[model samples]
Target chain A: MATPLLDKVEDEAAASPYITVTLRIRRFNPEISDEARWEDFSIEIDPKERVLDALHKIKWDVDGSLTFRRSCAHGICGSDAMRINGKNRLACKTLIKDITSFDRKTGATKPITVEAIKGLTVLKDLVVDMEPFFQAYRDVMPFLVTTGNEPTRERLQSAEDRERFDDTTKCILCAACTSSCPVFWNDGQYFGPAAIVNAHRFIFDSRDEAGEQRLEILNDKDGVWRCRTTFNCTDACPRGIEVTKAIQEVKRALITRRF
Target chain B: MSADTTATGSTAAISPVESVSVFDVDHPAPLIEPPRKRTAKTPKATRGNFEMAAWLFMRLSGVVLVVLVIGHLLIQLVLDGGVARIGFAFVAGRWASPWWQTWDLLMLWLAMLHGGNGMRTIINDYAERANTRLWLKGLLYTATVFTILLGTLVIFTFDPNIR
Candidate 1:
């Protein structure tokens, strides 16, 4: 009699409209312990809520200790890139409904594992130490160096000239492209795709005066020469950047100068 | 013989090894590809094998790159004189031995193949138009073959003393 009653209650709960998703987010508390582990979190989520929304809900409503970074809930900020369902993507753009498909009759929920992207030190949970990444960006001298005084008017250029390096300029300084690089993973000194892409932005710019110096910096064995062109950077780029093309342009520049 | 017409095009200038072509094999050479057929699709067998080989190469070369790159770091940075020891003499000394030469040759070949194969994967994935893919790969393969040949030539034809 008791078993039958329990089964009736379970059947009723299964047929309800409200569904709960379980996010097995990896947790790391460096000060507390040397070991890291996954903590299971079940939250009642609306079908339209994103994984980032759920993460915020968990952080604000449920647990204060669950760590991650997000800014400008839009994709432009590029502060919230993480591994969702074994792929690097922006939390803002990834919707829960797209990632999870439910069988209406069976009522089984597909669980997604969320973690930080690989090849960077995890500061806490989804947050990584981005200092080194920015250092590499700065090392490439990502600036427009003009020999003339400040332009009196907006720098006028032909449409084709701007379009030449337009693709490289869309980089949001996101680590998605850099972290996805295998060369960056093995050799930390290698100027990864993001830096090279930025370098290419100026290398192809018609108004820049430092092309020779920049080319010299990129000619080192650890510089542009080190890029293996695996194109993971291109595949992982959320902004749809032509990363390999930029690197090829740098290679061409170096070769042209060499001959 | 058919290469005589195509050789007149800009393709010859793009390749650093100026005289080499697939059709004319009067001398012993590495693999020489037949002149590309504009109307034909890449033969299914070669296409599939090349793609498969490229994919496997990323993983295999990635694993070896890790070891070679790490070993290179240990010797150059972590060892005795560190960055100061790296110079023309250091390279000259290292290349003096067959072991080091072979090591560098393998590194050069593997990295270039790994990189060139990686770029081929990207080209297949992205370059939408057939002509775009063909020309881009033509440029890529030309650059890759040139670098590989130049590197091999430099290694084999080392001149310790110069005027």
Candidate 2:
């Protein structure tokens, strides 16, 4: 009995190779369930495994009907972004051990809480309707517009010119940065950060000829003025884009007419 | 699509490509949305640095307000005595000092403007109807102006020797 107790003590002291953590998941099924509810899952996982892998394990072994969008398990496809521990983040990007939850009583570690990103209508569990997000993106005309002339060759620009808009090009059309914004949470009409980031991509591109038209489009009341520079979008960006800075650049461009 | 094709006739460019311009066959066209409205009355892009100025103002005022508020609370509720020690005489004595008078005045002005601007943001965010936002902001401006004027007058023209 003494030897077994000593072994158990040493195992716990080592933090154990496989640690048990609780996943407090918000569940919703509009057709069946009248209101959303929280469900707890206990799984033993390595600290290095991503939250996406944990979600996969839960779906495969525990609950078959649980629904969420994911493709290209890497961070590139940008399909698995959701609210993790009360902030917008990519499931594939956030590791289980890297994030720790808060305890109300002990003020220490608690269960990992996962919820759907706010501002969009949640269809099933983790799935949110992305139509509104894509609408704002389309409003900015994200594609390069060059009515001047069909380039006999590709539109050529110096490396310096390419670097001007290089940062905004990293956006994978993921709405993580946009949904994390307090302004977006409050007002649906406000063009959120993702759209502005996309606009910045083209507005500063030296090869793009339709900067004036794009600027005019963004000059509406719900445009750049609505951004309060809260920096939540910057924090939530999975691609490491400086979202608030891009918005300020657009604001500066609108003011100075120079991009 | 490339320069190496100069040896071959540029047949791909001449041939009718898939109608991505008109309609994409693989993906359905995104539903057309009515454009966001713009008007000549609103502040145009030519209006330079107004929003930027407001953003800076908020940060500066916030820092100042923090100092003013903490000092005020310490004086009124902690230092000397407590809230029970405060009265009309206390207020009058404080106002008599030019330094205290200036501090109170600054606090009043900054708080009113910050609050009013914040309320304007709230109205912009929540008031669904345009007329509703206009009316709400109008009321907020009126109230802010009224309070600031009254407070400023009080600070400047306080009668320390009232019977």
Candidate 3:
């Protein structure tokens, strides 16, 4: 009787197998050591679980010292962006099954290295200090600036005009697009993509009257001109925004001496 | 006996391999990626492969950029004279060397291409109208190719002592 039960359990386990993937996370503890080192965790997980889920498991069970920042548990928050398997991606959205399926030889998966967004100080395991990212956004004056009095009635906008700036308005203040940019990585002064995209949102707005001021602010060496349009920002944007398009439009606007 | 069974039977009978010609007429195949005949041959519609290449260029260039950029920072800011020493003389001396020239050239070329391709990708993905894409990319590529060629020419043929 026991033998039959064991056989049934084994058969069930074989049919729905759980995969073990190694997560080689970079560990830095100011209290422990001056330098950072890689720490590997072998965890069994369902194929559909995301890397963010794996990190949660590691933090919850495997090791308490592993530190990272995450919110909303979805791609919208953009808090969980990390270098997974050498590419920058949002941890919540990237399913482990998709990554492992690509590996033909070893259905086994390699450790998905998790690190903070580059070009910023890593506060801990996967959280980088985001002050610099936000500073650039602030410098761009992300809020809409209207020269005249506020609209007393509902501000009317044509459908086509509204659609023009629709995509840019989807930005959730997530710095994934900004941090992934190489130009921003090189020069801190560069306004970066997110800031420019925000400025675009206001600049292109029909009601906004501060386009010239914002354009002048963006005209500096560290402003819109620094964007080399690497598309890393686009790839890294979990929001599916066409960031470079907004930057190019700004450039064209500046060149033609238009808004 | 059943209609569904007969339909399944007919499909099975006509194997995909055997009925490719039959399938071609009814199914209107995915726009066959334009054949790559050298310049002599002009295929009907230029599939957006040029744009695709520009897309791939961004990724490849981005990877190379990581190295070029990191090395550049290490040399210019962290090493020797640091930020203060960088000036026209420093640039002139660096450009004097073939190795540095090649490095700078590669950096310039890769950075510009990466950036241009990135902007191209942006134009295709965002600029909805055909004419808009054309004008924007025309300006972008014109500026990019012009800057790249001019920069390359200046780099190799630069005479520092010109009065």
Candidate 4:
């Protein structure tokens, strides 16, 4: 019975198609060393699997010490944003085959490089201190503001008004857009793209009475004025939020005081 | 658990804790100071509408400068005999008219302010040190003011008959 079970497991392993891929990760263990270093791990995985799967495999089977942040693992939680192949992306949404370079003749694959997002303190391997990012978010007062008493039923809004800020509503609080910004990388004081994008979401909302207040906050020296319109935020946003365009809208609102 | 491990509590149900703390709770790790973090010394945002006005001035002055500059360029470099015709007398002839004086005056002020504001933005963006930004902006303002004043004086006091 034991032999049959062992034979069945071997047969399953042989039946599945797996390809060898190398993951080149920038590892930082403060306890071990003060400096970060690059480490490589080779794993057998399916090409269609997400990059998160490969990391999971390496951590579970190869090195239990490997660390990264992930939750939901479906791109909604926005916890696993990292630099993949020099671009900011959610690891859970990136496929191995999509990012890997394969040589057709030799059937060889180039290693996928992974690193922590820039513009934030890296706590450990692929884990960054999110407090700064969240601090910027909280500074913008990202919520509906009204002076009058609460509505007995519900606040009403038009379809067009809701659609006005539809794009920025998709933000998952991921730092992908903010970290990819060159300005933020150089100057941490700049409110960064994510903050401006969040401010835009409310500034254009028809029902939000405090648009002027948010605009004033963003009009500070380090606010929306710092954006150089590099469009890196737009490209880095996994949720397809037009991050730069939203920032422009906020700037316009500041100028005209009209949504 | 072994006797040695029990004595040290290293082999308790929980594994041995790393002896070193990766990060200190008192002093959190930050590659750079947060930009908007407030301290007792931090001043309020008293700079109301200055940046907004500057941004608007850049665009408005840019539009006006295009007309003044291109017209001036066309007259000086392309209208008559191009570069060769631009002599001291030619400048005096243009400055002789109040219309041309206003035009040239507008061009100098707009261009200087426009370019000066651009430089200010660059300093704010690139200069990492506070002292560096202050010194650079100081130099920029001094140079900009000197150029504007000198240009205005020359335009106003041009002597057509001075050989």
Candidate 5:
């Protein structure tokens, strides 16, 4: 098995499709030192491969102590969200060629920077403490609530009503949008875009009867009012949730009391 | 063999019990505090519509201000011989009409409130400390109130002929 794998790797190397890429990772370990530092690793890899694959290569081959969080290796799980080249993106979704600036004349490429998402405490290297993000999510009451007897069948909803909140339902509870927000970076108390997006999902749902309660909860001082309409959350959302638009809708609902 | 067995028995006696657990259901590990945890010192949510009203007021006043401000600017700066024609006499002549008085009054109030609210929002966004925010807002409110009052008095009790 080892001989066959080595032969396949050699065959692939002969194609010369690989380019040298440098990954600059911001590392932090409290057990060693309190301050975080940048570490670089240069590897020869296919340009079409993901930044996550490069991280894996560095961890597996170069340094076994290199740490980061990743699961599923696909975009759907949202476990590998990190700041890639100063923008919040899923590491698995970001291709190496897209982030690394390639020079045609010299055949050189810029180093891809990977760091933990902002506005959250870094646990180790790329992993962040997600407790606060989840706290905000929980505070929004991101679920349907109803009074009176349960319906024998499902609570009926029209196609148009379902479409109203269709965009916000794609959230994967990733901190990309929240951590990208400038307001949240300064004041963590503010319920960030992800929470507001989740609230919008339930607030507009025809089956959710607790819309008023959730609205009241979000009407707090640290709620949607803090959003500066910076559009950063919209730009950072991995699911293309139109986070800012959903926030605006929530604000409108608060004002008009109409979905 | 007897001596070796005695040494082994003594070593086993020194070892701690394996059945005893450090943490159990009754005495568990302490929970880590959430970064943005709301403590007792944290103020309760106002649970008011003040922010919504402020947001809406910004838009509504903005639309009205566009018309009022543009009309005032055109009259003062561009129309009827431009800035050269504007003087004490021009102001008195404009204030003689109730329509102009109402326009000026509306413009003064709306502009002050709009700008003041914008400053309040900026203070809230940037000010990290609660005391800092309070003091800055106090100063802003004082300045805003003084200006509004002085402007209102000037508009309402205008003595055009005062030397």
Candidate 6:
């Protein structure tokens, strides 16, 4: 047992030349701290490793108290979305090699900054209260709406009709795009990009009967007008959903009652 | 992981009449938005096309502004000795023509509106507080109106030969 442990240490040292990275994460402990503070932890990681992996190592090996949200580890769940290197992105999706900049003099690792998405209240380290995000999604009524369905068969639709709103259907409810929005950050009540993206999914659906109602809900002053076409949402979206274009299409649909 | 309200406290002690969300999955609360002063500021449903009109106007005016501004520069500066040869006589000569007068007038109005709207958007984005935003926008509109009125007066009342 003692021999294996010593050999394992040797194996790790002999492993591929790993890069040392400093993760400057914003920490907030509601119980202990009155204000949020930045904490740095240096870890040796492979060039291909993700920010999430570094967080896991810090939580598991370095400090068990380190906290963050992660699921599936593959960017599908949209749970690990945070500001990575000053831009909103999925922690699992962003790699350390791409974001890190090295100091030319000493070749030292420049710290990678990570913070919670803006606008929402942060519950603790890197975990925000997502209730407000979910509430905006709910306000848009994100499910397919139909009435008086007597046919037991699946609603038949042409391929062209399905392609109409196909782009918006790719949204995984990640608030990266929404939270990066300046308007949403300014006004808490604004519907934000996420809600508008979800609305576009159903408003363009051929079989949906309640398109008018959803359009009515989004036609208010806070609905589409608040969007300044800043392109922040489009840049922040890890899914490449073309969030700004979807918002424009929604705005056009409001003017001309046809989607 | 999602926010775990369970670890926050016991369920029995929570109040029943609370308006905000009590639970994530069950007994969800409706999103309480800030009360919009819709009556005075943003028009009602019947008049919601105001923003739509403004949006459409920007694109159309931008296309026109491009033509007007480029034509203007080409005649005054690019075609000749750029800015060195231009003088009061040059401006007086151009404004004397009804065609140039109308062109300048249209450009003035359109450019002011476009620039004013652009500034309003910037103010809205940068100004964090409500009162600050309102004050900034109010000043923007006032300056925009003043400039527009003054420029319109100059165009219409210009006498090429004051002597």
Distance from true location, Cα of A41 in model 3, Å: 0.8
Indicate the docking level reached by candidate 5.
incorrect
Better of 2 and 3 by lDDT: 2
Measured by TM-score, the strongest candidate is 5
Ten-residue stretch with the least lDDT total in model 6 chain A: A28-37
Model 2 misplacement above 4 A: A1-16, A100-109, B1-118, B126-135, B144-163
Q: Which numbered prediction scores highest in DockQ against the true structure?
A: 4
Instruction: Give residue A239's lDDT in candidate 6 (0 to 100).
Output: 92
| Per-candidate TM-score against the hidden true structure | 0.58, 0.67, 0.58, 0.85, 0.86, 0.77
Q: Clashing pairs in model 2?
A: none
Say which prediction, candidate 4 or candidate 5, comes out ahead on TM-score. 5
Q: How close to the true structure is residue B99 of candidate 2, measured as C-alpha lDDT?
A: 99
lDDT of 2 by residue, B5-111 (tens): 11112212112233333323353234322222222353444534455556557778999999999999999999877888999999998998999999999999999
| lDDT score, candidate 6, position A235 | 97
- Candidate 4: interface RMSD in Å? 11.1
| TM-score of candidate 2's A chain against the true A chain | 0.90
Chain A TM-scores in order: 0.87, 0.90, 0.89, 0.92, 0.92, 0.92
User: Residues A95-175, candidate 2, lDDT per residue (tens digit)?
Assistant: 988896557887644778888888877777788878778878888899888876586887789999999999999999779
**Lowest lDDT 10-residue stretch of candidate 3 chain B:** B1-10
On the 0 to 100 scale, the lDDT of residue B65 in model 4 is: 96
lDDT of 1 by residue, A51-121 (tens): 89878876765666678988898899899989888788888888877788666887877666889877677
After best superposition, candidate 4 residue A94: deviation in angstroms? 0.9
Per-residue error for A66 in candidate 1, Å, reads: 0.9
Tens-place lDDT digits, model 6, residues B88-118: 8988988889998999999999999988887
Evaluate fnat for each of the predicted models and list the values in order.
0.00, 0.04, 0.00, 0.14, 0.18, 0.06
- What residue runs in model 6 are displaced by over 4 Å at the alpha carbon? A1-20, A46-49, A95-108, A228-230, A255-259, B1-47, B78-93, B159-163
Give per-residue CA lDDT, model 6, range A70-184, as digits (tens): 8888989899999988899999999888999999999998989999888887777788878767877887898878889568899999999999999998988879998998888
Sliding window of 10 residues with minimal summed lDDT for model 2 chain A: A28-37
